[model samples]
Structure formats: C-alpha cells, structure tokens
Target: MKVVIAGGHGKIAMLLHPILEEKGHTVKGLIRKEEQADDLRKAGAEPVVVDLEKEDDISEYVGEADAVVFAAGAGPGSGKERKWSVDRDGATKLMEAAKKNDIERYVMISAMGLETPRGDDVFQVYQQAKLQADKALRNSGLNYVIIKPGRLTNDEGTGKVKIAEKLDRGEIPREDVARVIAEILEDDTIEDVEFDLLSGDDEIKVALQEFV
Candidate 1:
C-alpha cells in the first residue's frame, strides 16, 4: 500500500513510518517545513512539504495513494482558530483530495469523548472541530475508519490494546496508537467503523479481530 500521512513530523506519525515501511508499504509524509524533510527521510518516509493551513486545494499534494491518514493537529498551545483550520478544515481537504484521486481508504486519528464538549474555551473548540471532522468523514462516501484514542502519552507501547464503540476515559501510548493505525491500514476488512482505543491486555491483532 502507498500511504500518505498528514502531519508527517508528528510523534505518532514518525513512529508509523518505519513500521509501514517494514511491512512493504510505501510511506509518504506531508510536512509544512522543508527542514522536516530529513527527519521524515530518516524515519523511512518521503516528505511532501505543504502547509495544511495555507493550502486551499491540496489534492495535488495528496497525489495518488492507496490510503491517506489525517494526523494533523494545531497542538494544545494553539488557539481556537488553528483548531478549526488544521484539525477540521485540513481533514476535510484531504477527504476532498481522496475523492478526486479515487482513493477509497481513509483513516482518521481522532480523540475519544468528543461527543460532549469539555475543557476550557479553546479546548472545547478543539473538541468541536475534531468531532465535526469525524462527522464529515462518516458522511463522506469513501471507505473510512476513525480511531478515537484517549489521552496520549509518550510511554513505550505494550503492543496490546482494548477497542470498542465507546471506551471509558483512559490513556494509551503514542506508539501503541501508531501500531493500531498501521494494523488498520493493512487490514482491508476493517472499514466504515469508528472505535475508542486504550492500553489493555488483549494483543493488538486479537482486539482488532473482535471488530472484524
């Protein structure tokens, strides 16, 4: 599979690149800065420089790919505007690009517990933006999978996870989340579904098999 990931320089995405490469899939990462190219290259992904915030039409940047993953975010420190732009608009743009390019598979990295707004004003906006983006993907005619994980941490992955339609508020390592995304990308049987993820006792494949 030829996979393109938005927010290529992100921690989770950087971890995902080498895993996909080892699985014999071509990986391309979309980055905003030319300086980030070397980092992506070292991580086993080709870097395509395009600012998601500034680009109006990003179809060309998306190009031809078997699948696309929306992993971009405006960050916790960013204000409300960037939340809408990068998290919501950027994802929709990729959806449009996917439709235009005839790519059927799209995977979204969303957050768990976004149904009800919470947190401070900016965070509430972030939740709203992410929820809106997930809804757009659901409505989109393309084959899509939305993986909504709980709070993310930098701890080492356990290679085990629990997945369900709705999971209680919990946390998972960024590495494990990347592992789940990689698994979903490779498994064509998993589609048109959304789930919450967290660290657990079940092996990654076993947990995913339950969904299948």
Candidate 2:
C-alpha cells in the first residue's frame, strides 16, 4: 500500500517512515520547508514540498495518494496564530483536499486532551487547533483513524501500546504512536474507529484487539 504523510518531519512521522518503508509500502511525505525534504528522503519517503495552509496548490498530490496521514503540527517555536493556521485551518484544508481527491483512508494524529482548551493553559491554542481538526476527521465519512496521543517524549521506543476509544490521558511514546498508525494501515478491523493512544510494553495489535 502507498501512504502519504502530511507531516513527514514530525516526531511520529519520523518513526513511521522507517517502519512503513521496511514493510514495503511506498511512502510519500508532504513537507513545507525545503530542508525537511532531504531528511524525509533520507528516511526513505518521497518528500513533496506543500504547505498545509495552501493545499490547493498540491491537490494533485493528495489525489494520487492511496492513503493519507495528518501528522503535521506547528512547532513550539511558532506563535499562537501560526498554531491556528497550521493546526486548525491547515488540517481542515487537508481534509477538504482528501474529499476532493476521493481519498477514503485517513489517519490524523491529535492531542490526548484536546477537547478543552482553557485560555490560561500553556497549550491552549494547540488544544483548540487540534480539537477542531480531530472533530473534522471524526465527522468525515471515510475510513479514518484518529489517534490522540498523550504527552510526547523523546524516550527510546518500547513498542508497547494501548488503545482507548474515549478520552484518555496516558503518556505514549512518539515511536509507539507511530507504530499504531502504521499497524492500522495493515489492519482492517479498526476501520472508521477513533482511539486514544498511550505507551505500553505490549503489541498494539494485541492491545487493540478488544476495540476491534
């Protein structure tokens, strides 16, 4: 299967690229900065420079992809307005592009506690932006997997994973989260379902069995 990642430079995407490529699936990364392209290419994913906020310019790429993954996010260094633009509006635009291209399978990586974004919260803007994008994917009538991961860390991968359908607040490894997304691409049982994810020491397939 061919998979197109919207944010190839992201932490989860970094983990996913190698795993997907090793599994023999063609991978393409939608990137913004030209510098990211070299990194993505080195990771074995074809990189396409396309800003998420202006996806109309790259509708052709979205149309050709067999599956789409929304793994991009505005970095911590970016301002609040940029979060809204890249996380909220940018995600919505990608979903629109998916619709226009008739792409049915989509996976969106979101935050664990995104439903509420208190003004004083340090990540309030990010929460709001993610909530909007996540909600859109939930309502989008496609084979979608919305994986909301908890506080991300740079810890080395443990491969253990968990899947909760409702809201969850478990800490998950970025690598573990990436594995879940890639596993879903191969598993058909979780079709049209959304799950909250966290790090564990067990295989994601075994962890998600009940939900499936």
lDDT winner: 1
* TM-score (all chains, Cα) for each model: 0.99, 0.91
The total number of steric clashes, by the backbone 3 Å criterion, in model 1 comes to: 0
Residue 139 Cα positional deviation in candidate 2, in Å, after optimal superposition: 2.1
Residues 1-212, candidate 2: write the lDDT tens digits: 88889888888898899999999999998888888888898898998888886654456766566678988888787778878888888777777777778777888887776776655544787888888788888787767888878888888768787667764566877878887888888886677777777886568888877667
The Cα local distance difference test for each model comes to 0.95, 0.80
Ten-residue segment with the worst summed lDDT in candidate 1?
Answer: 203-212
- Residue-level lDDT for 57 in candidate 2: 48
| RMSD each, Å | 0.6, 1.9
What is the Cα-based lDDT of residue 205 in candidate 2? 80
Those runs of model 2 whose alpha carbons end farther than 4 Å from true positions after fitting are 55-57, 118-122
